[model samples]
Target chain A: MTATQLSPGRVRKTPAGAAAPGRRRAFDRYLNPVLGAVGVAVVLASWQICASTGVVDPKFSSSPSGAFGALVDSFKSGDVWSPLGSTLSIVAWGMVISIVAAIPLGLLIGRNRVLYALTDPLISIMYSVPYVVFLPMLIFWFGIGADARVVIVVWSALFPLLINVIAGARNLEQSHLQVSRVFCASRLMTLRSVAFPATLPYILAGVRQAVGRALIGAIVAELFMGSAGLGYVVQLKTSNFQTDDAMAAIAVIAVIAVLLNHGVAYLEQRLTFWSRTD
Target chain B: MNDPRRKLVVDDLRIGHWSRRSGTFALACDGLTFDVAENAFVAIVGPSGCGKTTFLTALAGLIPVESGRLELNGEQISGPSRDRSLVFQQASLFPWRNVVANIEFGLKAQGRLDAEGRARVAELVELVGLSGKEDKYPRELSGGMSQRVNLARALATDPDLLLLDEPFSALDAQTRELMQEELTRVWQADSAGSGKTAVFVTHDVPEAVFLADRVIVLSSGPAHLVEVVEVNLPRPRGPEVKRSPEFQEISDYILSLVMSQNKPGRRTEDHDSNAALSR
Candidate 1:
């Protein structure tokens, strides 16, 4: 009764006989980026030094500034945007398709023992085979068109999302499920209230993996008989012995991948806030 | 000692699970025949692995009965129903849901939750002494606080029979004692109004004696009802009741019964006493 009179926040602030909140390590939040920046600076400096001192052949290795110059040149020429756009579109659609298809399938498989028994082996086999190894088959089937690239991206992205989602559903806490049953909750109600929210953190984790794989899939697909993506630009430039231009394209792709991953991570943190605190 | 308005009846009930690892049926409890009168607080005590949880699950209709009869309010208990709400040992509050939202979960599931339901939840929050912590998520709560939310949530549905499975076992001793007191208060509150019957399961003898009007003891591994000792101690029980001679005597008696059941190849000294009581 006394505890109720004070706000819950103050109750938390004024720890009773219960456990006190654990103090975070010094500079916990800022330490990661600060250390990361220092590491990146060292790598960049070493690369610049190597390129400048001619320790590595310029034909094979472009200095950071040279790559930057090529990046500006490509942008000014107005030719890079379309390829960049194509790559982005491919990744976006591929991830969307994978997520939409995988989550429901994962839920079904996770919930249904019969369905899981029947398809589990097939799923495992498909997952085991590196999806990129299917590039030749995809190109042959879809004939080097955007269809082939999209298929490759979808294939690459699908398994991680599916596996993680299945895991999420499968690993649902028995106690939570029991709570639902005790209430006589409908199946749909149980799914919405317990299963879906419980699986969210796992699903977000899957998305993180899917984003990385889908991006790689898009680029890899473009490398094989494609003409309108950043990967194509990189391939085209490299084959023509334009290492700086190829490096520039690679740089853009890396930045995009990092940003996309960070975006998903931020969303994951916001949505599954309980996981962090718990 | 007997009431005409019986809320529950479990006669010759045999409960078990199919052990896939061993490919055999494992019995948890058999011949669990008992009647809980309306508004009675019944506590079940037994050794660890005595199917206390399994018994609760059976009452909740989570697990199917192998061969037995279970009736609630003159109706056959077939499956999990909203009429019987359960509070698990762990708080089992949805990690994603805040305290108030968790309390509202059962109401929301039944679709009976409305603006008026908010007041019901608020009442439960106060009843469990968790009024201010309504918005805090389960993660933000200590073990005792989470279990309070769990109890509040169970009470939300206004169930006919409240099934509890050692709901305070996970808390520290002090917190557990506090929770026991809180539960007695809540039960007293419900006692006057709906007369909600509760079957509380625990291994703690003192806890059983303090809260229950009657404590049912079971033997482990294919658990059988061994004894049901009535606590003649005064009600509106507080911490002072725990120190009373009557409370200590009953607690010691149940402890002796439980300890005897745990000893391998030892004769049960209270067997005749239990059989005579049942008769």
Candidate 2:
């Protein structure tokens, strides 16, 4: 055989090879987490520096180390566990109630023109009203037990889920519905196959927003009227001048919110695997 | 699959739509009367506003008919049924389902997606030249590939009649031509020996002549059935046959018919001109 025939340079590289650099940069999977970590580190370092230098009063603001020390002390004393468990359970049940009530109602209003017309104005009016403003009245009617707390939580979180699910169902493509019809799909079959999957992404987006509202609801109800839960602990510690403990509880709340948001976002990404974000 | 000999009969059919903008019910297709023999490839060709799509959808039972009798295999069609499958202008593959699952959709709907049914879907995936792409999603496919999946999904149910409404109109010229050839092969592929019948709608004249056994031309307004021209070209025809004089003549004839229908009140123009000159 000739030397030219065996030479590695004789074979041309594919266009994909030439395009590899830009393509690799376009979707470097590590870029997001690395940048996120950098951003979080910068925020924490600045806050720590401000607290240690007395740029902000450490007594009121509490330094990062002070809050971390308080967190460790609360864990050892077993004061954080019961409150945390109670808050988690209440928020979980409230979300469950809201989802069950809202999904069916949203579907009904979304699919039917007459039903949508009838309910849309009322929904708008209710949504515009600040649900947090009703806490005092709720405590008056139901008393400051789990009932009132759960009601407040559900009330705050329901609208986002309802509105999003309605938009998702209403905006379902006519062509997709027509595909089911061409196959002679029944109404139930069409709902199960086409409408459900189409609404999932929107529902997940709603849930992401609802998580923040639910956390706020739990905090507000517990801090203002209830005698238990993490919000109560934060309020008690703050009023008693235990600023570090209050800051630590608030930090935990922030962490919980972040975790819940990320969890739903991950679920959305997995379910809508066919969608192209870029 | 139930009776490959099923025929479609439309008698005095009228299709009307309520125009929300105009607040009027405009008749789209009026007094449309025709019969499609079993296993015949029929193409409906006309101008843009000719309601060819309306006619196809009416046959599919998507729209309610104003007045007429429509029958398939001597049975009345009041609603959409698996007996007649439709291929849309856009592929309309479910974005959430992968290629194999998209093809399996109809089978699942019919509750026939057993082990054998899955095997049939695999065969269809191969038949459409998408064997290696069985797990790929619709967004990952090119326009032609997606339409192939659409065609396979329609055939998966083994419907007696296939309704196509400009299925390749969205494709580019080169891809459209290749898809047309692929479609002809898939339709004629008698591996299962179903002998599926089809009714296609398009505004493209050459496409009508090339892929059809008979081309049905319609008038511009209200889309009255203007003429039905038989395409007696030999079978196994390819892009090479497009260069043949016979194919060109047939294409020219259909184009002229469409052009004549498109021009309104042309026959009375001379009389109006003579009167104006005398005045």
Candidate 3:
């Protein structure tokens, strides 16, 4: 059966004709950035106006100019680089650990029913519990340092990666499995040739989800216990009534999160190009 | 050790599953015996729920035989092996692997080839008329193309016995016909050097007649061999052969046998009449 038959319910339509090149290009150009700029401009203008008119206290809710000044000061002082580097490093390490652990475990659980049954309830319970609840326990175990932060990041990110990978492996077509059997493929050959490639898309989707969760876990853990990181800076500024500095730090975190999410998405698309066409 | 004349023989083969409540034999086949000669194409045609697939699976060693014995190359049949390959009704090509990679899978499995495997894969891809689609994954292929890849994958290993289970049933009428012709051509061409045996299963009588040297008509559930009709049609068969009188005659005979089996009480009436006449 064709992909259309395999996946029923969606009605696919082809474009009737091609539009003029210039018009299409223009449509693409205006799609996102224009809307984003407009959104940013409105928020910044409203904040500036409210703070200047004393409608909102400048000390509590910093003006756009105050936030920009904080942003500039952080850059000039060179302190921004170290914290940003630390946050990225934690996220990277957490992701690496997640990938190494989750993919093989997912495949193992997916292929064997008994293993799946044994782990199913445990994974469900663990996944359901919020990661924040583990932060105190993690700190007690690893102490208030990078180790504790990394543990929290791993906890938050591991589930999505594990679940998606298992889903991918579980849903592989029985026909393909039969084909593998007919060939008398070795266990390793089947895993590498049939199972791995088939499960890659779902694994990538899991990674995409993990990226977002990892960032959240890292930032939150840092806020609670870190001495030097973007989250730590934000927390320190908030305590000292430096609202502008905290806002600047928050903005940097948002940009980093967007970038990381998009990066994973791009890699997913490149790897599973066949999935989209199908 | 290299015997090219080996034949598959089944003697008094009985196959059944455990009954849900009683845990006893649910459906049994008794005194069901047949011999498929080397290089022969045998087709099993019967109504749905006839246990034709069950019999094929038994022969392929996919299911355990409850009683009697089955032999491949004069040795007792065992579990699934590379010597016998199955083509399912659906072309179960690995969606993740491209056409060439899919075809090379079997070769890779057997540890049979090296850099030369690529050349062999290319040749098979060309033989299947999928020359330009080496890099195209199964998802991107049409139903016919995917089935072609499935056929190619099976053939790549040069299996001694090829079992096809309604392989063309999912295609459109025209595509099915084309695929049949393509399969015939491939079989004829491939058999030139190394002879291979094929057992095809189908519900279509004409397809059975067109493809098989012998058509085995099976009785409904707990299936047994009802009749075995031989086709004397010449090799390198074309679409024109399907219109021949001999082809129609065999097809009609098989159709009647199938129809009679479907009607309740017909077998009893015929048996009773024959018995009475003998008395």
Highest-scoring model, lDDT: 1
What tens digits encode model 2's per-residue C-alpha lDDT throughout A1-278? 00111111112223455557876755665677899999988988998999999899988888889999999998999888888888888899889998898887787788889999998888877678988779788988989998889999998999888887788788787778888888877788788888877777677777777777988999999999878888998999889888899988988888888898778777776776565433
The regions of model 3 sitting more than 4 angstroms off are A1-29, B1-6, B18-25, B28-30, B191-195, B265-279
Per residue, candidate 1 scores C-alpha lDDT tens digits across B1-279 of 234456688789898777655666767788887788788899999887777777777788877788887888877788889888999877778888899999999999999899878789988888889978978988889899999999989999888788988899889999999989989988888532654789999889999999999999988757888988998888788899988888888899999999888877533232322221111
Per-residue alpha-carbon lDDT of candidate 3 for residues B1-279, written as tens digits (9 for 90 to 100): 225443888777887766554555555456677778889999998766666766776666666787776888877777778788877667888766788888888989889768777676777788778998999888778899988998988888888888887889889999989999988888877632444699998888999999888999888766778988999998878999999998899899999998878867422222221111111
Candidate 2 TM-score for chain A: 0.85
TM-score of each: 0.87, 0.89, 0.90
**What is the Cα-based lDDT of residue A83 in candidate 3?**
92
DockQ of predicted model 2: 0.32
**Candidate 3: deviation at residue B96, Å?**
1.1
Return the DockQ of model 1: 0.47
User: On a 0 to 1 DockQ scale, where is model 3?
Assistant: 0.40
Candidate 3 lDDT over A1-278, as tens digits, reads: 22221212222233334465877766766777999999989989998999999999999998889988988888999868999999999999999999999999999998888998998888887778897988888888999888778888999999978887777778776667667777888888888888888788788878888899999999998899999789998999999999999988988998998899778777876777666643
TM-score for chain A of every candidate model? 0.87, 0.85, 0.91
Query: Candidate order by TM-score, highest to lowest?
Result: 3, 2, 1
Worst 10 residues of 1 chain A by lDDT: A1-10
Q: Where does candidate 3 chain A have its weakest 10-residue lDDT segment?
A: A1-10
**Model 3: per-residue Cα lDDT at residue A147:** 78
